[model samples]
Target: MPLRLPPLPALRFFEAAGRHQSFKLAAAELNVTPSAVSHGIVGLEEALGVELFVREPRGISLTATGADYLSYVSEAFSLIAIGTQRLPNHRANRPIALSCAPTFASRWLLPRLPLFRARWPKVNVTVDTSHRQVGFPVDGFDFAIRLSRAPVAGSAWTRLFGEQLVPVCSPGYLESLRDVQGTPLLSNATLIHVNAASEDWQTWLEATGAEHVDPDAGLRVDTIQLAFEAASMGLGVALGRRPLVNRDLESGALVQAAFNTVNSATAYWLVSAENADRRPELLDFRQWILAEAAQFSCDTSVDAAAAQ
Candidate 1:
């Protein structure tokens, strides 16, 4: 007696399509035409006696059944890759591919990456910074760092840190203010805005009871890094995430315009595929990052206590 299995080619095509949510992109990846990918999926559906995808005007989406099947297939593929990499003759040269938010990457992670490299000399790391949501194994990422109210679906998530928004500006900018302690100061001062973040001047102003400030009046930038840069250059006051701006504050490049810091609902989350824990390198990175985050939290608590 022999065990039955899905056709390898069909399985490969289906996995790629399900991962990308598009037959066209899957076809490009598999080096086949879209029609071929479609045909392969049809053959797979017929063989399995189930439709895997729902066709749409904009793109294709996995059916409920397809999504379930993809999880198993993705796990199997990941395990196989892990096994292959662990072979005796194999070299440990593969870099851990991490997808992270642009602002977090530029402001926080990049500054600390050298520490990781110093600790794990043999391990390599590659980072891709984007605001787009990652699709796990299909996207070929080992891990991702996301800023969300909660964990993302279909992957393990570890809460890295909560965000505290504070109004920050260059020392020169603060010195130039006519009345730093005046209620009219916020209303009169120029504001710098990070377009994607929800913790804007309006939220900060409302939290700090500084309703006189016009929330919408400011220069808007696409990333927090840009807003920080603008603020550092004395362009305007930007709402800074405490963890991201800690180093700048310490270096005197920026100063808090006020003592009003409000915690945001969203936090940084570390996300990875279902089988990520089974991989040694992923586990190492996870442990290391969590430890670093814990230390950062402790340091922040001490700083707050001292300030109080």
Candidate 2:
């Protein structure tokens, strides 16, 4: 007997619409107009002989039938994706593309990436540095390192590391603020602020009881990397997130203006599409990254204990 199925295009439209519960959002996901999505769903409903959605002026909502059908449709798509990925490929040069924040990519991940390459010489890796949140499969990234207070929805998330905030500056910059008692007065120092992380400076100051320093007065930069560069050039002191400044501090290019470091609410997380674990290369990368993070965390703890 021949298989009975609705048109693949209509089913795809229905799945997107049902998942989002909005025709407009579904159209955006499918890169089609709302009218096209509406027409596709209409055809799908006619073929199925049932009402799938309840239309509203503000937006559409899936009916009980549509909600029930979506579960099965979603599972079918997952199965198809897994099967497709499992197919043998002659090409051995497929690269794993990863997205990360510019500062984290340059100051942290890139410095450590050579180690990964040494361990997995056969694997090809590509890194994209941007502040924008990755959309996983849609954005064509195999994995993403997101700095957020919480994990993003609709993906598998793993916590990589937490962050600490500290005021950092070049040695020359620090010396310029020394008082008669040989103490650096942060209140008299110029501040360099990261536009996206403006609160970090304030948070650190408040935690350290340095309320005399004005957090609002500073030269603002778009990224943490730029702020670090500005600070290194003797422009101003910057609130450096620990992970991004580790190498600089170790190399003596940057130093803590004060010994106080405060824990930050944000942390780095590794995220991938819901079914990305099915890919062997992705699994290998995940394991390697997790192990690296574990070792780094242990080293950081040891250093902190010694400092105390």
Candidate 3:
């Protein structure tokens, strides 16, 4: 059977007009003149065989039929949008989807995303927050920023950055703990830990040769963001990623508890299957990421050199 659908452009015009209740406002939003909006609405109404809006000096109002039909039109538009969004290659010029940890997405990738957009305006980028674990083809993901000790058994991995862990607490937490005398200020507050990095406390203790420090203590958090929030709320000390928390530190929302930090064996990696690795969009993304990583390495090197 032949599918009969209304003209998308005309439907869009009516939807906008109905939503704003003003042709002028709709025209402004659509970047068209009032005459264009009026013409589009008239065309839509003519095709539908019903008046959509009652003209008035004060403003326009929906007719009884217009109000009922408007609901269906709005709903139809929303469904069309969802269908188009998820359709493969619907974005036209660029269709790429990458998944990564939420904290990484917000703290690292989002700030740098504009550069990618400027460079490849036609390429559409979709970012999904998976909190560090994803299953590739099964998950409908093109690529993923994975955090692991090393390469997965059967998967190829490109090392992106090393893990650098440091203690952080809110400014208020530090001020409150500063004057208190007890079994060390740290013991008085709850320590926030990421459950994914289950052995983090033990690993830190072993590396620092402070084995006596209890590994099981304080508030346990399941995600990096939650740990950060807890620390920011003056709830406890949190082990934070230096790069991720750099902004908060600079802004004085969070402060480092100690200068010393441990570099863990685990690293953040860019992982994808064989087919995905060869994709043009993936290739472009990989090149962009590697370039940014190189810059970050150089910056860190210079900082370390200067500190000496």
lDDT of 2 by residue, 1-308 (tens): 99998898988888778877778777876789999999999999999999999998888888898899988887776667555555677233578889987778888788888998898888889998744445545445678888889987778889998888888999999999999999999988899987777356878877889868898897988888888889999998999888789888989999899888888888899998654576677788889889988888888788788878
Against the true structure, what is each candidate's TM-score? 0.74, 0.73, 0.63
What is the model-wide C-alpha lDDT for candidate 3?
0.75
**lDDT, residue 17, candidate 3:** 80
1-308: candidate 3 lDDT, tens digit per residue = 99887787887778778877888877866779989999988988898899999999999988998889888887776665546545777544546888888898898888898999999887888897733344334334667887778788755688888766777899778766664352235545567888987347667656766533466798998888898889999898888785777778889889976555677778788887445654577788888987887777677667657755
Clashes of each: 0, 0, 0
The positional error of residue 97 in candidate 2, measured at the CA in angstroms, is: 1.7
After superposing candidate 2, which stretches have Cα over 4 Å from the reference?
1-93
Flag regions of model 3 displaced more than 4 Å. 1-94, 131-133, 136-138, 179-185, 210-213, 305-308
Error of 2 at 306 (Å): 1.6
Tell me which residue pairs clash in candidate 3.
Answer: none
Which residue pairs show backbone clashes in model 2? none
lDDT of 1 by residue, 1-308 (tens): 89798898999899889988889888877789999999999999999999999998999999999999998988787677666655775545578889987767877898888999998998999898744446655566778888889975667899988888988999888877647464326666899988878767878877778866788988999888899999999998999898999889999999998887787888888887655676688789989988888888888778777877
lDDT of predicted model 1? 0.83
- Report how far off residue 149 is in candidate 1 (Å): 0.7
